[model samples]
Target: MPTDATAASTEEAATRVVAFFETLAPADVAALGRLYAVDARFKDPFNEVQGVPAIERIFGHMFEALDQPRFVVTGRVVQGPQCFLTWEFLFAFRNFDKGVTQTVRGASHLVFDDQGLVTLHRDYWDAAEELYEKLPLVGGLMRWLKKRANS
Candidate 1:
């Protein structure tokens, strides 16, 4: 059972994390130390890493690879020292669809330490439906595969 203070701490941590992601920029990658523990773990469909430095590198790569990549947190649920957040990632592909913006819907599960620093951050999203399906040649192949599978 969580006490009032525990709940409050979790809420505060969740709020800070959501704000950090929504306004994240290339410069903000260095500031991850403020919100994440020294040995925090982060995992998504394509990458999995531990420690602040590794996480920083992942986010740094994101900035280098995409154009105007940003997250819009749509909803949040905080419980004890954990939070679940639903979000949409918006970005323009530097190499693919030039000026067109793409949106990927996903969710993240965050676990915070007693001090309100994130200890674990795991993202959930379908690579085929949300990402690969948005590509040019790959998109057509994936759609055909989906249709074939259903039929």
Candidate 2:
């Protein structure tokens, strides 16, 4: 069980992470160094990177690939130095979807250091269902497969 002080600290760190991701921008990529430790590790469905520079590059590529991509933290739970956050990542594909807004529901598990900087950040989401299933031709196949599996 976490003490009151430990819970408070975890909540504060979680809040900062939510705030940072909500306000993420190309210009703000460099500021990630402040939120993450120098040797921080980050992993997601499509990326596994360590260190601030690598993490920065991953976010930078997101801006390059999608238009107006942003993360909205919907819920949060804190435990000691660890936090879990549920979020919706919203974006519009510049090339394919055009102006259509795409939403990917996901969660993140974060571990923060004593100094409050994130040491490990891992995102949990379904690539096939959340992403690949949203594509054009692949979407139809993916839906069919899901239906068949369910039935």
Best by TM-score: 1
Which tens-of-lDDT digit does each residue in 12-54 have in candidate 1?
9999999999999999999999999999999999999999999
Per-candidate local distance difference test: 0.96, 0.93
Could you tell me the lDDT of residue 42 within candidate 1?
Answer: 97
What lDDT tens digits, residue by residue, belong to model 2 across residues 22-132?
999899998999889999999998899999999999999999999999999999988999999999999999879799999999999999988889999999999989998
Each model's TM-score, in the order given?
0.98, 0.95
List candidate 2 segments past 4 Å from native.
Answer: none
Q: CA shift at 5, candidate 2, in angstroms?
A: 2.5
